[model samples]
Target: MEYVEIARAESERGELVLRERRDENAPTVLELRANGVFVMDTLETSTEQALASAALALVDRPRAVVVGGLGLGFTMHEVLADHRVEKCAVVEIEPRLVDWMRDGTVPHGPALLADERVTVVVADIAVALAEAPPSSYDLVLLDVDNGPGYLVHRTNAALYREPFLRAARSVLRPGGALAVWSADQAPELRDTLAEVFGDAEAQSHDVVLQDREEAFWLYVARVPSDA
Candidate 1:
């Protein structure tokens, strides 16, 4: 395996160390870390993309969306591909990841960062969630942790709890959609969604990264209409 030194940068939070490792026979790996905690990379983003798309697909009039994670802009890119998406608010926890994407260290470079509909918020996603009015969005996609179980950051576990899920529903229009991507299927998360949203479904997809495979599931919940 050939390892490439990428960059060591700083965000509003702490230092971020990035690296690219390429195996002789496998796909190139882009690794990211914030204050020494490992974040997401270029391994597999199928579920990420699906998280955004699934939310959109559930809403017939989805004009605006808030994506909680901006890991490689794969989910944002997928959302923008839809003509119906008029606005997108991407909230990223780490500011350094935005710099890495802008500086071309993350492969796609300026092309990914220069999109018109995107508004980058270099703050906690919960900040945006706190400020958004009720029924303001048609869709909400969260990729904060590895799902509800394996949190990349300990603080993120709260975002997966029932209260946060209801908060997600609070900002979405009646019958609007909420989609979440997880590394593994979380039954407890599913049950929480069921209790809060009234209608919940799970969709699974297989992700292949560096010849290693894993199954990812996107939990989708829809706010029910009284009618």
Candidate 2:
């Protein structure tokens, strides 16, 4: 296995790096790292794709969606795969990552961002959700950090707390849904989502990564139709 540095940028939060992974026997992969922490990779993105698919499936009208992170654009790409989705607003905190995607530093970045239904907003996702108008979107998918338990940044911990969760809820239209991806089971987050949205469910997705079977969790909650 070998890693070739593709691009690196220093952000206020930390250092962000894009690299190409070349394995002699396996296909090449692109990986993203933040502050030296492995963020995501192009290897198997079943979890990311599942995050978007499950949330969109729960909504009766998933025409407008908000994706909290733009790691490698896999989640965003999955979101756009649904023709029912007319708009996808992606909120990313690091400007350099966005620039890389736009300028082709991240190979699939340009093509993914070029989708007419896609809108990129370089801002803290928490702030973006807070400032958004009530009932602004039909679905909100958060893959910003691994989860509240495995945070890439300490500040992102707030994203799982009550206040920020409420903000995410407020931005959803009635009957809309909010889905959060976790690297591991976060029982507390599921409970919190239940409290905020009146009900929530957790789904486990078993995937094989690097020849190891791992389990990822998705927490989903939907606003009532009459709300």
Residue 217 error, candidate 2, Å:
0.8
Query: Top lDDT: which candidate number?
Result: 2
Tens digits of per-residue lDDT, candidate 2, 32-150, equal: 99989998999878778878887888998899999999999999999999989999999999998999999998888899999999999999998898899999999999999978888
List lDDT for all candidates, in order.
0.81, 0.91
lDDT (Cα, 0-100) at 74 in candidate 1: 82
Candidate 1 local accuracy as lDDT?
0.81
Query: Which portions of model 1 miss their true places by more than 4 Å?
Result: 10-15, 22-29, 34-38, 225-227
Query: Which residue pairs in candidate 1 have backbone atoms (N, alpha carbon, C) closer than 3 angstroms, thus clashing?
Result: none
